[model samples]
Target: MEELIKRVEELEKNTQKSSRERELLLNRICELEDLVEDLTLQLKKSKKTIRTPVAPKESLAINNASKKTNAQEDEPWLFYCPKNKPYEEILRNLDFSEGYEITSSALVSEEALWTQILEKMNEEEIPKKLTALRKLVSVQLSSACHHELLIIVRGIPGNENPLFQLILPHIATLAEYVNIAWSEVENSNPELLGRIALVLECEQDLKVLSVDRGDTRLSLYVEKLL
Candidate 1:
């Protein structure tokens, strides 16, 4: 009887030990799995960081290139009349580096010459000349003409004859001539029609008999005896 009891107790102890060993092995396996998952995540993050590190110099270069491109695109070239000798001389005399305003008389003379030149520009040269003149003169002439013509029309007290009267007839003829030239200009380049419109708008009082862009036209603005 005593031997049987001892044998049973030994058997129980052995079974408990085996169960404890199995539990310990499962806990160790779980810990190892957790460690592998953590290592894999760390490795992926390290590879990503190595592959595409941000470069300060490269970023600065890209920014500078973009700024340079923008500046080039925005900048417009200065323009001048190649045909008018006086205008050419005036432009040559101008010290653009000094940044000075051109004399009113000089600007007026240039405007008059440009008005005359516009009449002579044929189909082939109209586009080039108009583009050039827009950059040089058209941008400045509107306000200048208004102020100058007003001053001339309302002469100073000392002047015997108003300056406008002397030029009025010539101005009338020029207006008619401009109307004809603008028609040709419109036919050649419709884009420049706005410039003609601007001139007409600036000198609104000047009579424009007709702007016949399609065919033959005439201006009654010129003084006539009927």
Candidate 2:
């Protein structure tokens, strides 16, 4: 009976030890699976971070070049018309109208004279010639006597009076066709339409007018209105 009892106790001890070992192995397997899942999640996040896009250096360079080109194209000139000279002399002596011809000049053409006048208005220094240029534009508009005038106005850098207020009433009058020749203009060339629109917009008035771009014969009439 004593021997049988001792044998039964030994068997129970052996069974308990095996169960403990199995439990330890199962815990270790669970820990390893958790580590693998964490590692996979970290790898996926790293790949996503790496895949994010960055702007190319060449694209940045191209954008900068485009801005520079636009700046150069919009560069403004200075006005230099004097009151003491003949209309032809004022047109000729001014640096802005150096090569421009008055006889063949259209009312609204982008000739040297017109460019000079616009440059003067756009200059940073606000030269004394601005007054003369303004008068010139006003006189030209008055002489052409077109009912509907379109003016394109662009502000000059560093200018306090950048708005096209100086030519507003005249432009407005032209738009209404109150004093100018509306019939002849309607029958004339259409190419002057764009220039006329620009002039009208430049004035910055809240008025609307129609211009035809197809007529080339009215260019002379448009020039006179300029």
lDDT of 2: 0.33
In candidate 2, stretches whose alpha carbon ends up further than 4 angstroms from where it belongs are 49-226
Cα lDDT tens digits, model 1, 7-111, are 999999988797567546545655676689899999888874556665333211111011111123321111222222242233334321111122212223334
lDDT of 2 by residue, 1-226 (tens): 9999999999988887875675455456556766898999998888745555764433111111111111233211112121222434433332222222221112233233344443433432222332333434444444332322323332211213433333333333333331233223324532231112222112222223223323311111121111
Candidate 1 vs. true structure, TM-score = 0.22
Model 1 residue runs over 4 Å out of place are 49-226
C-alpha RMSD for every candidate: 38.4, 35.7
lDDT at 95, model 2: 21
For model 2 the local lDDT of residue 152 reads: 31
TM-score of each: 0.22, 0.21
Which pairs clash (backbone N, Cα, C closer than 3 Å) in model 1? none
